[model samples]
Target: MIPVQEREQTDDRRSAWAVFLVFLRLGLTSFGGPVAHLGYFREAFVTRRRWLSERAYSDIVALCQFLPGPASSQVGMVIGLSRAGYRGALAAWLGFTMPSAIVLVVLAMGLSGAGNQVPAGLLHGLKVAAVAVVAQAVWGMARSLCPDAPRLTLMALAATAVMLAPSPWCQVAVMVAAGLAGARWFRPAQAQAHEPLPIPVGHGAAIGFLLAFFVLLVGLPIAHRLFPGQWLAMADAFYRAGALVFGGGHVVLPLLQAAVVPTGWVDNDIFLAGYGAAQAVPGPLFTFAAFLGGAMRAEPSGWVGGMLCLVAIFAPSFLLVFGALPFWERLRRNAGAQAALAGVNAAVVGLLVAALYQPVWTSAIHAPADVALALLALVALAAWRVPPWLVVLACALAGWGLAPS
Candidate 1:
């Protein structure tokens, strides 16, 4: 008979593998961005698998939302970590992230090779679709996050500030200012008691992860300046974008635009087109990084660049989730922290609003027909409740049809 220890080890491996398989399915099929991804996760893990109690699941979601990164992706990582330790976390991330990342990278490469052959109408349609998607996000987030007058006012101010300044540092500063304003003025409603999370990480390990997160955040830029390699610079830019953005995948847009577009690393058209295509795929929207990486004008611009960017952007999420899980209980319970987070969330909505106007709106909406298409896309997304991927496909066809013969 197998020894008891050996049997237990085998079981652990099986558990990790199971986690990966489940999330791989999710990666392939889950759509509609972060909020929808959360619903898919809830159905798969809580209702179907009964992996954890509803409260426990919610608590995990809250913790991830409270921290920076893609909330849905972080939620998946936490669920996996709870089930089978660190190995399980890695498996979950790989399974959920890879499908979308791979798709975007391949798409980017194809667009690059297609060059002048790619239909202008199709590309334009994708940009129009992006405008609608960002508008929907802004609308939805406004309703949920800016319900109160104070928060609404804060959101408008943040939007105005971002639009006026329009830089990565400006965006980060706005979030910080909003958080401070929230801590001072906003009083968060008392939180409901939550079930304790089942994360297996200890405080020491958590601290180590947290330290690593900061070290990389600070060290990457300095290293890039000193070494000045293309790969290092790309890693630094992607890492900073991943680490700083408070909201989910959509909020990363302006930061990413600033990072790649100005440096002549990626053209504005390619960047926006990739973003538009990202909406059509499953899993996290952050996989747009893969597209940008693959489409870069310089060396390491194919699969190698794509993988580097995918890893760099997502690295912080892993570190933050692992680091924060242990201390999340106390942090969540802190009223001040909750209030500040509320403000930060409000700011996130505003930041998205600015992005909608500048890059998404200005780039896509050139004529009356484009406006009409955007309006229709928004209606389809927000009112008809049509699935996003379907809407994206329809828009692509419409754009192609409208192209000058």
Candidate 2:
């Protein structure tokens, strides 16, 4: 007969494997930038899988929004952690990140020789599909998150502020201001029953992780300056970008461009080409790091550099999410914290709204035909309730057909 403890261990392994497989699918299919990624996560975890409750999922989103690095990716890591401890967290990150990283790296290598050859029509189609996906996300999240007048007002103001200023700092400032407003005026009627997040790390471990995060943030630059190696320099640059940026992948572009372009690590044309190609693929836009790494005109380029940059850029996310969860869980239970989260959640939705309009809309919707295409995609997603992956495929074909022969 098998031992009970052995059986439990086996089950835990299976759970981690399951988390990996699910996230791998998401990595292959999740499209439409960070806001749309959140919508995809909500559908997969909260609505479809029932792995997390609605409020629990929102709480996670709210927390990730406050941290640096990619919010959607961090949410995936926390979900994995909740399911199967540290192993699950690693599994989630690897599965959800690798597909696009691999694709972008390969594309980067090919483009170096083949020149910028990806069809512009296909890329534009993907952007239009993204419009529908983001609209669906905003529509659904608004219904759930902004049910009250005060919260709705907060959402409008936040969206307006972000749209006007439209910087990473503005997004962070809006969230902070919204949090203060929530604390002062938006207290819940009565304390509702709480759904405790299953954070496996102890308080001591959490503190250690936070310390490590800061240590690397500060020490990496000094180490690079002191040693002057290619790998260390790349790590320091990518790590700082991930650690400091507030808004998600889009906002990180200028920092990345500055780091690589002026130094001639990557030619300016290749850099812009990779950014365009990044939108054509699924998964986090941060995977553009893989392209930059693979295309670097220096030693340690190709697959080795690609993987290294990918890990370095995303490392802070893992540290921050793990470190913050223990403290976040405790603080969220407080009555005051709940009120503040209410405002923050609304602000997050607003940020999504601004993003949907500026880059997602302005970039994609040019002509009446483009607007028609986006509307059809939206109908497929929100009304017919088709899976996003299928909609993306359909739109790509339509975009190709519409392109001049």
Candidate 3:
């Protein structure tokens, strides 16, 4: 088995910096959505840079997909953190999310119905870009993880389930359950595999960080309900939303709408409009929470308040993923565990597939031109070896002209 780089060696400033820049570029240039983000990721990380082995990358992706909270985005964070530590992860995450946050905030101030408008053609092109991006991800993941009929079927089922329920959290839960079941029942015979990456030092600290976050996530909300106005309430709302979020960004809408509308934060119009705009932008959708928070401007108002809301929403995920990552090596190879993961992974694939179709595809593919544009984008990626970033841009233009939202 090839020796994966030691943590100490991989955790260099240069590595982290590279990841930061890459994600930053992605946040600014990549279009469509999370599914598209994944495609751009593959084109850059898996295919272009060769940062991770195919299996290693796919495993991480599969795990993220099965769990929730912007699977692709989380996967990127995990990868960055794994290579560089807390700061590395932070840089990568911030770079990826900051652009969207900035855009959302700026746009938030302009939603007075008299906001400057763009040509419908441009919005439609963006949709085309989204379609192309998902197709790229589906192709890459299929080749890597779902190489066989059974695996493909598993992924298909996951997508179908999502189409039926359209509930992100449920989708994640289904995948997790399936993965755990697969690990238990279908453990592959032990063989030589990549040597486990060294656990980042002080596994205890990682666990503690995770435990503390979760405790607050569940505990603070109840405390807030009982004793409102304190930081606990703020923490509770954000953490609960973070904990429950499956697909991230747009998925956060339905859950958030229920939470805030009842509390008299913002009406449905603001919530849905922000969500749609979030889709139109290039960065993390969680930043929509930032926009919503800014709009709320209740107690912890202004940029600081928005930051708090955003931090609270994303904190649990950051903690949980890091805490679990140190142990992923141990878990991934365990037979009983592998059996469960197999099932879950398949379901995750399916869920992702469904997501690709609905929010990703349905939103964009409205015309025969869209179909053509998507096909051409695929050809560029699968055939001509073009960067996904370019494909997304081209498709966005095509969508703007052809479909003209």
lDDT of 3: 0.65
Across 36-117, the per-residue lDDT of candidate 2 in tens digits comes to 8899889988887678899999888877976878888999999999988999999998888899999999978886656447
Encode model 1's per-residue lDDT on 175-200: one tens digit a residue: 99999999998887877767876678
lDDT per model, in order?
0.92, 0.81, 0.65
Best by lDDT: 1
Q: Choose 2 or 3, whichever is better by lDDT.
A: 2
Point out where model 3 deviates above 4 Å.
1-15, 112-195, 198-201, 230-232, 334-405
> Highest TM-score, which number?
1
RMSD values, in order shown: 3.6, 5.6, 6.8
**What pairs collide in candidate 1?**
none
On a 0 to 1 TM-score scale, where does candidate 2 land against the true structure?
A: 0.70
Better of 1 and 3 by TM-score: 1
Put down candidate 3 lDDT per residue, 106-194, tens digits, no spaces: 65555423333745565466556555655665666567666677777777766676677765466556667666556655656763344
